[model samples]
Target: MTRTAQVVVIGGGQAGLAAGYHLRRQGVDFVILDAQTTPGGAWQHTWDSLRLFSPAAYSSLPGRLMPPQTGETYPDAQHVVEYLADYEKRYELPLQRGIRVEAIHRDGPLLRVQTDSGAWHARAVISATGNWSRPFLPAVPGRSVFTGRQLHTVDYRCPADFAGQHVIVVGGGNSAAQIATDLTLDDHVNVTWVTQRPPHFLPDDIDGRALFDVATARRRALDAGRDDTGGVASLGDIVALPPVRKARDAGLLQASPMFDRMDRDGVVWADGTRAEADAVIWCTGFRPALSHLAPLQLRGTRGHIATEGTRAIGEPRLHLLGYGDWTGPASATLIGVGRPARDAARQITALFADN
Candidate 1:
C-alpha cells in the first residue's frame, strides 16, 4: 500500500522542522523525512566548541525559542541540537529519522518519494535538503601527493585533536576563521590560514542589536534590487563590525591567496609561497544535493530548480527551499525558509481541496 501525505518535507534541520511545524498548525497532513538519526543536520556534525556567529535569538526554529545565553556571542553546536530536539518535542511534529530517501519520482498528480524504509505518495514535496548537502572542495593540483593529513571542515571536531602539529587552514569563510582561531590557541599546534579573499568580518553584536540585523538588511537590499554588489558585504560599510580586523592586525590571521597545489612537504599558495604543515583543513563552502530529484526540471545555471514563489519553474507540486537568493527571505537562512514553506503548505492545501 502506498502511504500518502498532503505534503512531504525532506530533511529535518531547522528549515524542515519549521516547515513541519507550520504545516501542523495549519492542520495539514505531512511527514518530515530525515537522513540523520536525529534532527539538527550539519550542526549535529559540527565541532564541540563550535558556536553560531548568529546569536541564539535569531538562530532559532519557528514557534520554539532558543534558550537565553546571557549575552554570549553565540550558542555552541550542542546547544543548537538540543534546541531543535526541544522544538520537535514541543510541537510533537511528525518526523521520520534515519530514513534515507533514495529518489523522488512523479506518479500522476502526486510525487513518489522512495526511501530505504518505504515510499510516500505526496501531493506536494518541499526539498529542504539544504545547501550543505555536499561540501565544495576546489580541485587543486598535487592535492593527492601531500604527505600530510587532509580533511574538509565537516570532519573537523576539536583543536585538541590537532595539538602538537602544524595545521594549514584553507578558505576565508567564517568557519575557517573560527577553526584557525581555535587551533592557534594550542601551544603545540602551528596554524596558517590560506584563502583567495580577505573576509569582511561582521561583529557578533552591535549597540544592543544582534549582528545578524546588518546581514538581514544586506540580504533584504540584495533582494530588493538596492544593492548591486555581488554578495560581498564589507565590514566598514556595516554597523558595529567585529574585532576580526584587530585579530588580523595582531598576526592571528595572515591574509593570503587560494591554495594552488600540494607540495611534497605541505602546501603551495597561488603566489608560489610554500609552507610545510602537518595537516590541511579545507573550509570550502557547500552545494545542494539534489541527486534524488533528477527527474525534476531545474532551470538554473547549475541544475537548481528555478522558483519564483513556492512554484517550481518547470515541475508542478515540487517546491525547493534554500536554493539561492531567488525567493525573498526564502533562501537566506532558517528564518528565510519559513515563508516558502508556508506558501507551499497553502498551495498543497488548495490542491487537496480541489480533489
Candidate 2:
C-alpha cells in the first residue's frame, strides 16, 4: 500500500522520536516509521549492564524529562528502553513499528519511502536511523582464520557467557572499557584488553551533562566564527564510569598494544609478542545506518551524505539526524538530538509555508 504524509520519519529510535516531537510541536502532519518490533529501538539490543554516562534527568528528549532511575545515578539499558517507550506514548506521536525502510526514491515532487510494510510518499523525509545496526569490526589480519570465538560489541550480553575463558577486548572507546571491566568481575574469566592507541579516559567528574554543555558551547563558538577546540571529543573517548574506575584502580584494566594479526590459537604483535585467547571482542564502533538512502546516491567518497546542517546538500527534501556532530553538535545522543530535530522540523515547516 502506498500512503501519503507531509513528512515521513525513518527510524523510531531516540532520534526519530525527537524529530517527531518537534514536528508535532510545529503542527505538521508526519508519521514515524520504525524497524523495531517494539518501541525502544537499539537500546533493546544493548548489553545488559550498559548505563548512560549522564543521569536520567540530564539525558532526556525535547519535551519530557526522563524519570529518575531509583538507586542509580546513571540509568541502565533497560531503564533507557522503558523511558523511550514511555516518551513515545506520552507524546502520542504517530508511529508505525516493525517497518524497515528499504529505499527512498524521488517520486516527482515527493520523496517515496519504500518499506517492508508499504510505501510512504512525503514532501520531506527525516532519516534518523542511528548506527547501532551496523557495528564496525576492524579488518585485522587473519581474523577469519582464528579458531577462537569472535564477536562484536553488539553481540556481547553478559560476562556469564565468557566464564572460564581468556577473552581479548579490543578498542579504545567507552564500550571496550566498560566491557573489559565487567569481564574482570568474573573470577573464572581472563581478559586481555588491547587498543590501537592508549586509552584516553575522560575526567571522572565529566559526564553526559558536561559533554552536552561542552558541545553546545563549541557549536556556539563555531557559529560565531570562533575556533573552539573544545567539545566532548576533545575531552576523551572513555568515560570513567564506576565500573571502569574500579577496574582501573584494581589494575585490572591494563591495556596492551593492539595485536598485528591472529593465528589459529592466538594473536601476534609486531614485536613477536603473542597471547592466547579463547574469544575476541571487537568494540570498534559503527558506521551510519544510511544504506536505505543508497538509491539517492548521496554518499560522498567518505561514505557519508553531505549536508548543510541537517538538510541534504543534494536533496533539499532530505534531512539526516542523530548520525553525529556533522548533522549537529552531539546530535546522536538523547540530550543533543533535540537541537537538530527542532531545527530540521522548523526548516521543513518553513519550506511548506513557502510552498
Candidate 3:
C-alpha cells in the first residue's frame, strides 16, 4: 500500500525544517523526505573552514533561537547542522532521512512522490532542495584538452589538498573568494580569479548594524525588476563601511573580467590574455535539480521552477524556499526560510479548507 501524507517536503535542510515546523503548528500531517543521510543538506558537504556570512542572530530557524555565538562572523558549517538538528527535535518534525525522492507527479487529486524507499501521496509538495544540487560550469572552448585537474568549487574540501599547486579559481561569488583566500593563506597556492560580475563584498558588521540591511536593499532591487536585463553590476554601487571599501580599492581581492576561451595549457581571458594554471576550480554556482519532479507543470526557464513571490506559479500548494528571489528579506539563506514557511502554512490551510 502507498503511504500518504497531508503534505510532503522534498528536501530536509533549513527550508524543509521550516516547512515541517509550520505544518506541525497548523496541525497538518506532513513528512520530509531527504536524499541525504541526515539534515543540513549542503552543509554536510561544505569544507571544514566554511562559515555563514550572516551572523548567528540572522541565521536562526523559526520559533527556535540559535545558541549564542562567541564573536561576530557567524558559526561554521557544523554549528549550522547542530542548530538544524535541534530545530527538528523541538518541532518533532516527521523527517525520513536517506529517502531519495526520484519523481513526483499529480495523481487524480493528490501529488504522488516516488522514492527509492517507497511512495508518498500528498495534496501538495514543497521542493526545498536548494540550487546547489546542480553546479553550473561553462564549456570553455577546448576543455577536453586541458592537461590539468578541473573541478567545481562544490567538490573542494580543504586548502591543504591543493598545497603548492598553481590554481585558478573561477567565478566571483563569496564561495570563490573564500576558497581563494583560504588557498592563498594556507596552501601558498598561486591563484587567479575569473568572474562575470564583480562581487560587492561587505564586512560582517557595520556600526553595530547587521550586514543583512545591505543584503535587504539588494533583494528589493531584484524584486522590483530593475535587475531584469543582466545590466551593470549593482553590487559595486551599494555603499559599505570602510573595511569593505578598502578591500575593494586595494585590490587585495576583486573580480576579474568574464572568461573567453581555453586550451590544453591555460585559460584565455576575454581580453585575449592567457594565464596558465595547474588546476582550475569553477565556483560558478548551481541550479535546481528537479529531474525528480517532472510531473508537476512547473513554470520555469531551463530546469528551474518559476515562482511569483511566495507562490509557485499555478501550483499554489507547492511553495519553494531556499530558492533565490522567491520571497522577501533573504530567501536564499537558512535565516530567510521562515517567512516563506509561514506563508506556505497560510496557503496550505486555505487549500485544506477548499478540499
Q: Give the candidate number with the greatest lDDT.
A: 2
Give me the runs in candidate 3 sitting further than 4 Å from their true place: 197-199, 203-251, 270-272, 300-304, 327-329
lDDT of all predictions, in order shown?
A: 0.73, 0.93, 0.74
**Ten contiguous residues minimizing lDDT sum, candidate 1:** 236-245
The RMSD (Cα, Å) of candidate 1 is: 3.1
Residue pairs with clashing backbones, model 2 = none
Poorest 10 consecutive residues of model 3 by lDDT?
230-239
Evaluate model 3: give its TM-score.
Answer: 0.87
Among residues 3 or more apart in sequence or in different chains, the pairs in candidate 1 whose N, CA or C atoms overlap within 3 Å are 203-242
Residue 210, candidate 1: Cα error in Å is: 5.8
Steric collisions counted per model: 1, 0, 0
Q: Which wins on lDDT, candidate 2 or candidate 3?
A: 2
Better of 1 and 3 by TM-score: 1
Q: Estimate, for each residue in 277-347, the C-alpha lDDT of model 3 and write its tens digit.
A: 79989988887666776777685666556676666786776767777654545666777678778878778
For model 2, the superposed segments whose C-alpha errors exceed 4 Å read none
Could you give the C-alpha RMSD of every candidate to the true structure, in order shown? 3.1, 1.0, 3.7
Looking at model 2, residue 266 earns an lDDT score of 88
Indicate whether candidate 1 or candidate 2 has the larger TM-score. 2
